[model samples]
Structures are given as structure tokens and as C-alpha cells.
Target: MSHEIRTPLTSVKGAIELLTDERYFKNNDQQSKLLTIAHANTERLLTLIGDILDFSKLDSGSLPMHFERQRIESVVTQAAQNLRTLIEERNIALEVLMANDLPDLMIDPNRIAQVVTNLISNALKFSPSNAQLRITVENWQGMVRVGVRDHGEGIAAENLPKLFKKFTQIDSTSTRRAGGTGLGLVICKGIVEQHGGQMSVESAPGEGSTFYFTLPAAPAGAPSTTAEASA
Candidate 1:
């Protein structure tokens, strides 16, 4: 994990060093583009590092849970907002559908948001530029299910079983094209399980894919609130 992180940090530092050189800035457009790519990759690397560290803490039973009532809609919205740039850049049609009667759930909002963001990012990575990605939230028999659906190149049947394995990618070509460190889904699964929830995926070749997870619902008949929380 440290090596994975340092790779991007080193690249970012190199980019910065180049930008500081007066001669390098002479080609403004090229330098700016290089810097942008380096900066974005650096951010992605940082996020991956955080997820790995969080997973480690959870595995060691050292991660603390902060449970509080939170609006599911808000958490979903936050995740969407974080990826708004990518969605817009790719011209992907993004939608969020929430049931009118959805109830507040107790969870670590930051961690849940991370799971949502990872799933959405994965969807975007596999999908075509103009494909549609939909996020749906609903109450299901005393549980809350959040679904991230993508009209993308679906995963092969043989690869489904290994989807959540750490450092596992669907295939080498896909991993190379998508530029992932292969720990995103693994971390997502860990986070969901830590919240007493279940994460899963459904897909078919030539069709779309939907990644869904179910979290325990707030206590029966508990009062609902719209306050935002981190997940």
C-alpha cells in the first residue's frame, strides 16, 4: 500500500518540480495538462491509501464506529456530488432515485459515502462515455438497499466470484484500461460489512450491471430526520 501511494506522490512531486522550472512553463497548455493529470491521479492514490488504512484498522478491530441517525438521500447526494466532475466530463447520464418514504438509518456516514463513491467510480470506469448510471435507494423489509446501476461492459460470469477479493480485477486488460489499484471493491465490501450490511453485484454480458448493498434499517418506528452525516 505504501508503495502504491508513494508512486503517485512521487509523480505529483515531479509534476510540481517541472511546473516550477521557468522553461517548463513556456509550453503552458502541455504543462498544465500534465499537471492536471498528475494532480488527479494523486488524489485518486490518496483515496486508495485511506481506504486501505481503514480496512486495516477494521481488520484489527481498532476502527471505531460513530452511529447516528442520517438521511439516506443526503448521503447519496454527497457521493454523487463528489463524482460530479467525472460524470459531467464523460457526459454520463446520472440519476438518483429515492423512495419518498425512505427512513433514516444509523451508520458511519463517511464510510458509507466512501463505499458509494467507490461503486460509482467503478461504474464510470467500466461504462461508455454516454452510458447511464442510476443510483436508487429504498426501504426493503426492515433494511435499506442502495443500488448503483451502470449500462457498461458487464463482468463475465467467471469473474463475478472474485469481484470483492483484494487486489483482484476482472481481467488484466480491464485493469490496465481502467487504471485501478484493484482495492476499491474490496474496501467497499469491508465497509458495508462493518456496518452490518451486505454488498453484492448483478450483471450479464451485453447487458448492464447493478451493485447493491443492504444496510440494517433504523430501529422500527424510529423518528426520521434529514440531517446529513458522513459515510
Candidate 2:
């Protein structure tokens, strides 16, 4: 199914690229508008396809985990920096607050960063320009909790139940504007669970939303499978 779908989608993407390129319909206003819609939807389709493929691998538990002792500040900072350009362009304030005594974690740095990035990205989608989105890391029980809070219109109670479900869209109009496959948070939840942690969300309409997840701290003398990979 993937192969069949990808074959046509690839052609559509290539065709849109040609039309939108400087060498082609760059002078045609109508074609330019059509090209914009075509290109955007094509990319959306590709994103959806990729999400499905990853979700399938997740279900099979075949996704590789290269856990290591990683520093929270470094991981969270990298994630924030990745979205810095978008945050600035949207005129939103992005803050990362890490507890000074936060512990090192036994986790896939890339995967954990992926979760942080996903949460922040979703927050950005709902956030009004000039609003604030903060990523907070702290000690939670025996684990480390990272939270992404966005001060926007906030989510409704009815949408809360569907927030982490695959392919679920909170609001059709909002989702269309946001331009995502809606699997970002679901993927984040799965990644956190793989690390023996939990992912949860708290929000109230007009009160904004906070998405958080916990990661177990690495025990003393914990070995790095990542290092083992090199050995």
C-alpha cells in the first residue's frame, strides 16, 4: 500500500516542484496560487505517510533504542534552539527552564529530544503571536519531568481525550491551519513509554495547556548502549 501510494505522491511532489520553481510558472499568478495549494497538500500527504510508517514500526517494537546517560540541559537546549527561528518568526517567547540539580537520564538523547521538539512544536501551533511557551525541566519523584506549556486559547475538555490518539485532530479548522498529521504527540507518548516513563497533559479552556512527560534518571554507573554500538 505504501509503495503504491508513494509512487503517485512522489510524482505529484515533483510536478509541483517544477511548477513552483523559478524556471517554470514563476510569472503566472494563477498557477502560483494553484501551485501553493498543490505543494502544501502534497507535503502534508508525505508527512502523513511517514507518520504511518513510523507508527507501524512502533507497534512492532522494532524501533532501535540507543540509550545513554544524557544531560537534561543539553538535550532541552538543543530542542529549543531547533525551534528558535520559528519561535522568533511567530513573535512568541520560547523559554527553557532546567532545575540546577536535575539528574542525568538513561535515554535515547535523540528520542527524548524528539519528544521535547514535538511538544514545543504543537504548542507553537496553538499559540498566538507574542504569547509565551515555556519548556520546564525538574526533578519529579525519582524521575525527571519535562513540561511544555503554552499560553493560548487552550484546549476544550472534549478534545482532551483525543489529544494523544493517532490521527486525531482537535479541531478541523485549527488542524488545517496547523498543518500536521496529528501523530506528533502520539509519537511523543510512545517514545516516553519506551523509556519506562509516562506522558500526560493538563489544560483548561482559556487557561492554556501543558504537556509533560517523565524520564527515569540513569542509575549510578549506568552503561551506554550508544557507546557499546561504537565498540
Candidate 3:
């Protein structure tokens, strides 16, 4: 029911936001303000709805995945680059450190990218402006590992366990200010697990946080063929 309603709302919101552009409204300040508010709310609602749907699918073991042999560097780099504008706006220094000759992962590139994006987004949220965010990719214990490290107020020991829980926020005030439905990490963990990987985090109160996940590397000498899988 929610999705049914959200479909049309998304279309209407897109149209409304387009009209909110200065070139479209010329000197109509009042009209632009109204449209902008509507657009923002619409985006919020859409994000909430999408998160809820994704959570439901993940919990119900129905999320679709496409597994293929992909370079960890390419996927991680693409995911980080997609958020380049956001990082630049916050004056955050983004560094990507990839190990030499990392193994290819047998996973869903899009799903893995989504996981990377979510981790990076969370890191950016807690990190202060002008802080540094680092993404490191390397081969670990026969698996390919990707880690996102952020210089921010790190997660507490107790709250660390709750990081991947559904609808969980370590600090409500901080998470609310950062803007998320609290399902991002839950979904990310689910996606990684579905690909035979594990997600974990390391942090200290003031030392910052590093969220990492590992996926099984493609078998040695195996053919790089695409395959469809589902949770």
C-alpha cells in the first residue's frame, strides 16, 4: 500500500522539484519556496518508503542479487565517486587506499556498491567538515575486504553491537540530525551476508570508526560468469 502511493508521489515530486529550479520560476520567490518545501518532504518520504521496502524484502529473504566476478577497486571507487559532490560540499578529505593485486570478488557489484555507499554515507554523517574519510580495499584471509574509516565521534562499546540492528541508532539526536531511517547498516549487512561475506565495525569513543566487510574472492582459475541469486 505504501509503495503503491509512493510511486505517483515520486513522479509528482520530481516534477515539483524541477519547477523549483531558479531558471524555471524566474523571480517567483514565494512559489519557489513552496515548491522547495514540497520537494524536500517528498524526498524524505520516498527515502523512508524505500528503506522500509528494502528492509522488508531483506528480512523476508527475497532481495535479488546478481553475482559476478568484479574488481573490488572498481566497485569501491565508483561508489565513492558517486558521492564526490557530497564529500566536496563538506570539505571532507576523501582518500582511497587499495592494496596491490587484490583478488576479484564473487559478488553482486551493484549490491556491494550499495553496501559501500551506505557505509561511506554513515561515515560522512558523523564526520565533521574538513575531516578525512578513508576507504581501503585489500585481500584479507583469502577474502577481499573493504573498509571505510571516518574521523568522527566514534561509536561506544555498547552501541557498537547495535550498529547493524534493524531500526537502530546509537545516538538518536546525532542520527536524526544526520538524516537516515536507521535501516542503512542493517540492509548493508544483509547484502554482504547474502554474498557469503561478513560485515563488522571497529571504533573507540574518540578514535573514530572503521566499518568493514569481506566477500569471498573468486576461485582461482574460475571463469568469470554472472549468476543470479536471491536472499
Instruction: Compose the digit string of candidate 1's lDDT tens values, residues 1-231.
Output: 557766867777676767756775664777677767766777767676776776676667666667677877899899999999999999999989999988668787877898898899889988889989999999877789999999987877888989888777776454578876567787788778877899999998868789999998778665544344223
lDDT of 1: 0.80
TM-scores across all candidates? 0.82, 0.82, 0.92
Off by over 4 Å in 2: 1-39, 226-231
Relative to the true structure, candidate 3 reaches a TM of: 0.92
lDDT of each: 0.80, 0.83, 0.86
Write the residue-wise lDDT of candidate 3 on 58-156 in tens digits.
998888888777788889889999999999999999999999978777888888888998899889889989999999988899888889999998878
The per-residue C-alpha lDDT of model 1 at residue 228 equals 41
Candidate 1 similarity to native, TM-score: 0.82
In order of lDDT, best first, we have: 3, 2, 1
Candidate 1, residue 159: how far the Cα is off, in Å: 1.1
List ranges where model 1 is wrong by over 4 Å.
Answer: 1-27, 220-231
